[model samples]
Target: MSYEDAFAAMAAGTDEAVANALELFPSEIQTISIDGADHLLITPQNLDPGLANHLLIHVHGGAHVFFSPETALNSSLAAAHAVGARILSVRYPLAWKAKFPASRDRVVAVYRHLLQDYPANQLAFYGGSAGGGLILSSLQHLLAEGTDMPAAALLLSPWVDVSGTGDSYAVMSGHDPVIDYPVSLASAAREYAGTLPLTNPGPSPIYGPIESGLPRILLTSGTRDLFLSDVARLQRRLIDAKIPVELIIYEGMWHVFQTSTGLPESSTAWRDFARFLRTAWAID
Candidate 1:
């Protein structure tokens, strides 16, 4: 299939996933607009009105080709229930429809709009895979612009180095059963990068200056994840810069295994995330 056709085929598969997510994690989804952009506001079961002041913004990850704001409800619901707060899943334009800074800029705009009613400390961001990478790069964009920082962020199996400049890419080529880098994965990166160079630090935040304007970040990856090296390198870079960061590695798990939710490992990851957010928000 052509690149465009491949992306379409990938997107076409989102319906069943969204349906499954709904059935697996029942929640209320509202389409709220930030200016003109529509985002998914998920109020999962066990939501606490007392924690209404705290907000979680999510960006879904599907190699920037699959999954939309509404389609990302599975994890959004899981996160809302985990933290007992509402989540706004940013509906940034996908790579196939818009490339490069479009995803980053749209998120920045949504954040800026939300800043009107909520203090930066009241907000936190989370995403997995491309979504996590997008959050990282968008923060880079915000940093370059000298914007206020949020309380913290959770990046689950983040694909920080979209340039594919990591040891795991080579080592886990045959190991990661979920992601086949040699297949259409590279092409998806190209689709996301478009005219931009893969290493511009826009598409690949690993090359960006993350030393400042960043809140504490929690990054998780598994030994079998293709982006394990990316997470490890990012952790080292943050530590070298004296940034408050936490790295959690799970054994025998692959990219975004936290989404499985049924695994004991996934439960631990979410509980750890809850503690991280509690500390960031100063919630006892």
Candidate 2:
């Protein structure tokens, strides 16, 4: 099979898994069009003052390749349930189809449109895997454009440095079962970057300057996650830039393991996540 064919096959297989996963989170989801792009608006019954009238902008993951629009909702299921807020999950185009900055720019445009409807203080970002990296890079663009930032962001196993320069890439080469570096992410990263360099910082935020103008952030990853190095490195970079950041490393977990709603680790992680959101929003 061709490369695109293989990606499509992977996506088709993942779609079923994601669909099954969605059933685990009982939320009312509605699909709306934002500037002609699809956005899934999800609302779970649980309510929190921290999320009252607040919006969580969710970016979904698939290494910029796999995962469909429906699967995007599944990726943010934890956030919808934990945050107990209305979430607008942007259905950014896949990198294989739209190229490097296309996916990044689509997310920014959705954020920009949401800004007009909600105050920056009432908006925050939540994403995992590639979505996490995308959120970081997109915020960099926002800072460059002098745009106001949201209150907070939470990333789960974000692949911030797609260049595969981190220690985890080498150390976890034989460990991380979720991703095989040479066979998986390495190729996907290149496909996502398209004509641009992998270390462009626009796609790989770890190489970029993590300056001010970013919101308070939280990042979570598993010890066995291939992106562990990415999250750890970015945590230090954000701290060096004086950003209020928090990092949590779960024991014996893999990349984006939080998506497995049935896992015990996932339960604990989402509970911990709720606490952070409450603190960030000063819900008390």
Candidate closest to the true structure, highest lDDT? 1
1-284, model 2: which lDDT tens digit per residue? 65679766867777766676567667778888887787888887675655668888888887878765576655676677876777888888887677889988998999899898898988888888899999999998998999999889899988898888888888888798778778788888998898889998888988987998799999999989988889889999899999999899999999888877678998889888878876776774
Q: For each candidate, what TM-score against the reference? A: 0.94, 0.94
Tens-digit per-residue lDDT, 1-284, candidate 1? 66567656766766676676677667788889985788988877777777788889999998888777765666777777778888999988878788888888889999998899899999999999999999999888887788899999899989887788888999999888779676747888988999888888889999989795588999999999999999999999988888899998999999888777578987788888888987898885
Superposed on all Cα atoms, the candidates' RMSDs to the truth, in angstroms, are 1.8, 1.7
Q: Return the lDDT, model 2, position 253.
A: 93
RMSD from true fold, candidate 2: 1.7
For each candidate, the alpha-carbon lDDT, in order, equals 0.85, 0.83
Name the 10 consecutive residues with the lowest summed lDDT in model 2.
66-75
In model 2, state the lDDT of residue 217. Answer: 95
